[model samples]
Target: MLTNNIIFYSDESSIKISVNKDLFNKMYQYCDKSYPNETGGILIGTYLDKQTAEIVAVIGPSEDSKTWKTRFNRGAKGINKLLKEYWEQGIYYLGEWHFHPNGSPYPSNIDTDTLTSISNNSKYSCPEPILIIISGSHNCYNQKSYLYSSTGQKFEMNC
Candidate 1:
């Protein structure tokens, strides 16, 4: 079979997420404490994989929101500013991270639909589109990180 050579960028698969540990800790903590209500944000960085948005850092919503939808919309707005920063630094917004309170850290119905919309909205959205879900099991730290494509297909990061 003659197939085009598939060369995924290396040297980054082993790179531990450079996102501020404190930030991840906070997200993880929030999810753990807010079981059932999902908490989520975006990860920005210069990563090789499209879906696995290397997690250069984690951003959360201000502590006043009383609804998931509110926080989610706030996060979307906040990410626009962050995206500008990433562009200036030649970095990219890889993927999103959210918590699945008391549930598996995988894309739920809303998540799949949301990411599907993201895919349609941008050209940068491509292969390995990552959507990380930190379950109530132990926040984002202990919770598993699942990767999903723009088409709502799930996969695993090289890590």
Candidate 2:
């Protein structure tokens, strides 16, 4: 069963990430499968307001993705097709989610750079993207989410 809602807040913004409990469990399962390696996926949802959004689905790592102990590079294979399908179902691309494997939930330099690049990319058309990082192994996982703006502002999500 899915929960009714999950709230993430900050001094500057508040977002209601709507994810079913089943989906949330599945996300953890993905991390369990990856274990010591890194794993990531896209977040599919819709914006409710300027400072609010809903997470409807999470796409797991692709077969072609590159995963390592300290890094994760999401593959492009079939992503477009998946996005299109989700779009048809009224779910838009909101941002990304990944696991840190054996690290903290804090975003690293590479993570920051990736968020900046995503915000700046004309193809994405998302000036602000949400990032969710799950740190630690399956036995003891810690999750943190953030919102990164194109102007280089980062806000930690408080749940």
Candidate 3:
């Protein structure tokens, strides 16, 4: 069940965001190679069956800014484009994703702030957007994925 603007799906929960394996790899590379410090992107998807949110795509910034670590957000202009696309179809911003160098994939204080800002900034916000953290770049397939709640209040899954 969803409460306080947070939802999850497991082939059982109401909201389910379908993840694309190919796109997941891209996000991983963004952090593991191009930007070892931090990598971020947007989650694109359609609202499903009036219950779950299924992630359909990913969009990363061609530009970025360093914030103690690197940060990526869709530019305002790009977001406008995305909004128009969403309206045309019926989908909207699903959530946000990023990388964690060595932290436990847990929500750091800063992470909580970011999530809060996202939730409060828009009328189209989900109870919580899917927050993904890729960790354990210690080697290769050993990478772990952590899913944080929309509010960055807790881990929805292990990463």
Candidate 4:
């Protein structure tokens, strides 16, 4: 049921990221299902080169995830297993995606901090990670994509 793909790139034109339309729709569904509460999950995909990457899958929030009207705390339950399975198939963690529930499609301070931590965390093994934030109601949504460097610098990508 997925069709088309959304692509984004950094202003310096050094990074290109793509996501399947279906996966976006799926994210919207998760947001809608969560209603006034916030929700999010991890992005799974592969990098084509040093500057281009494609997101192939989206994992919904785990059962242990906590949501609030203005904040979300993604849980880690079962994520390691999922990532391992995808790794065996040549895919891996690309980044994170979250819903803002009628808020702006921008990274909040906490969001930025989280991405910084992920980028610096030796466990994730990703020096640069992407963060996608979707904002709005059920069918009417807006999104912003950012790539975070290990130093915590955020680069907003144009869609």
Give the TM-score comparing model 3 with the true structure, all chains together: 0.69
Q: List candidate 4 stretches off by more than 4 Å.
A: 1-3
Model 2 lDDT per residue over 61-144, tens place: 988999999999998799889888888887788888999998999999888889888999977767788899989887788888
Estimate, for each residue in 25-119, the C-alpha lDDT of model 3 and write its tens digit.
Answer: 77767766634466667777886677556666666653543422444343444666776777688767876777766545555566667766676
Return whichever of 1 and 2 wins on TM-score. 2
lDDT of 4 by residue, 1-159 (tens): 224877899876488998888888999999999989999999989987877899999999999999999999999999999999999999989899999998999999999999999999887878789999999988899999999998889999997
Q: Could you tell me the TM-score of candidate 1?
A: 0.64
Task: Say which candidate scores most in TM-score.
Answer: 4
Clashing pairs in 4: none
Worst 10 residues of 4 by lDDT: 1-10
| Runs of candidate 3 exceeding 4 Å displacement | 1-14, 62-64, 67-77, 138-155
Q: What is the TM-score of each candidate against the true structure?
A: 0.64, 0.91, 0.69, 0.96
- Best-fitting candidate, scored by lDDT: 4
Name the better of 1 and 4 by TM-score. Answer: 4
Per-candidate clashes come to 4, 1, 6, 0
lDDT of 4: 0.92
**Model 1, which residues run further than 4 Å from truth?**
1-23, 32-36, 48-53, 62-75, 123-127, 137-141, 157-159
Per-candidate Cα lDDT values, in order, are 0.54, 0.83, 0.57, 0.92
Order by TM-score, highest first:
4, 2, 3, 1
